[model samples]
Target: MSLRIGQLPDRTPVKLSVSVEPDLACALADYAAIYAETYGAQEKPETLVPVMLEMFLSSDAGFKRARKALHARASKGDT
Candidate 1:
């Protein structure tokens, strides 16, 4: 019973600490404000940062290719 979709990945949450330049911090705050206005829901910049990063990583074709290659190598027991 092969399925097109693979098994779901782990959903455990990990906490990360990051530092940004003042200007970038301001930009994140502005983005959060715009997002709140667009969606009618308020979210802190900190809350949005990880989601934005995940979306960015998911959208990168090169990253996807490299990740796939790494997974294939790991599956093959290649160091």
Candidate 2:
């Protein structure tokens, strides 16, 4: 018997707004800057956020674990 794996369909573009603590935001920016500097790239940190998010979301285990944790937290009314 042969096994087949299905691919995810393309998603529509959506706009999301999120607010982060000032320190967290600064830390993320600093990390991004370091990454860019290490790679000798000129892209701004803001441009890296979506790419990082997509990379994380694209990993099967990472996505599943994140979703499970998020659901569990939501069920606990932690959000």
Candidate 3:
């Protein structure tokens, strides 16, 4: 089922933090930076986070395609 804006449940914001490996952190930063560069005019952090979340959550098709490509590359290397 598709989500409707009016059908969303009420929610409260909570603060959460997690640690990532240095390389992974760098990757995330790089992704955010590129997003800011392309879409961000002034490159505000406030705008960047929400947009990043939206992109991540909405990217099921992209993620599936990426996973398939990665598996193909790995299998090719194993042969």
Best by TM-score: 1
lDDT of 1 by residue, 1-79 (tens): 9999999999999888889999999999999999999999999999999999999999999999999999999999995
In candidate 3 the C-alpha lDDT for residue 3 amounts to 61
RMSD of 1: 3.0
Cα error, candidate 2, residue 39 (Å): 1.4
Candidates ranked, most accurate by TM-score first: 1, 2, 3
Pairs that collide in candidate 3 are none
Model 1's TM-score against the true structure: 0.80
Candidate 1 clashes between residue pairs 3 or more apart in a chain or in different chains:
none
Q: Regarding TM-score, does 1 or 3 come out ahead?
A: 1
**Residue-pair clashes per candidate, as listed?**
0, 0, 0
List where candidate 2 sits over 4 angstroms from the true fold: 1-13, 60-79
In order, candidate lDDTs are 0.97, 0.81, 0.70
TM-score of each: 0.80, 0.50, 0.42
Q: What local lDDT does model 1 show for residue 47?
A: 96
| Residue 68 accuracy (lDDT) in model 2 | 95
